[model samples]
Target: MLRVAVDRDGGVTLDDVADATREIDRVLEESDVMGELPFTLEVTSRGVDRPLTLPRHWRRNEDRLVKITLVEGGEVTGRIVASTEESATLDVDGDTREVLYADVAKALVQIEFNRKKKQNDSEDA
Candidate 1:
């Protein structure tokens, strides 16, 4: 079994996955890279559980909530406002904080099921 993770700035869509799968399949079929071995190809997007280790990962996750564990032994949860090659600016509890990528041991995107609902509710009122 093979897994392919497709990622983008906004997010990965069904079309994106389909296109990538098709292209990869075409390439493999043309090259016979598997050498007659039966295998399965699975194309997917980067999951929320995936850790943010690269500058591009942080940049692509802008406006999303994340929980970061510092190398020094502490954790911080916030929404990513902006990111650069060296660091990320996050909005934590209405305050903006900058955290260096080197200082981050691990960072994972947080899932919010009702965040949009809450925003819409506030807008309606």
Candidate 2:
């Protein structure tokens, strides 16, 4: 069995994995290869935490909050200040600015919306 997930841009989320698994299943069904190999396939997005280096990645996440980890071990959290195919700039620590993507090792969108209510509820409780 193979499962597939389509992204906002209509990109194949896990096409390679799904396709390969399906092909193996087909061959096993047809030829009885390796005494009936059982297989399962799942395809899905990288979730909301996908990297934001590609221009398409940033476009899919416009207006969202993101966290960027610099190669130098510094971290910057900001609303995706601005993005391009080449790099992304971040508004960090209020007024501080960082051009992150070019030198970043990792970048992920932060789940900020849910955190606010959780914080408020904890305080009220």
Q: Which candidate number maximizes TM-score?
A: 1
The sequence of per-residue lDDT tens digits that candidate 1 reaches over residues 81-107 is 999999999999999999999999999
Evaluate residue 58 in candidate 2 and report its C-alpha lDDT on the 0 to 100 scale: 69
- Distance from true location, Cα of 34 in model 2, Å: 20
- TM-scores of the candidates are 0.83, 0.54
lDDT per model vs. reference: 0.91, 0.64
Candidate 1 worst ten-residue window by lDDT: 116-125
Q: Per-residue CA lDDT of candidate 2, range 1-125, in tens? A: 64655456423445555675577657667775445556564556647866766777865675567877889888777765566677665656566464635688888988865644434456643
Q: Which stretches of candidate 1 lie over 4 Å from their true place?
A: 117-125
**Full-model lDDT, candidate 1:** 0.91
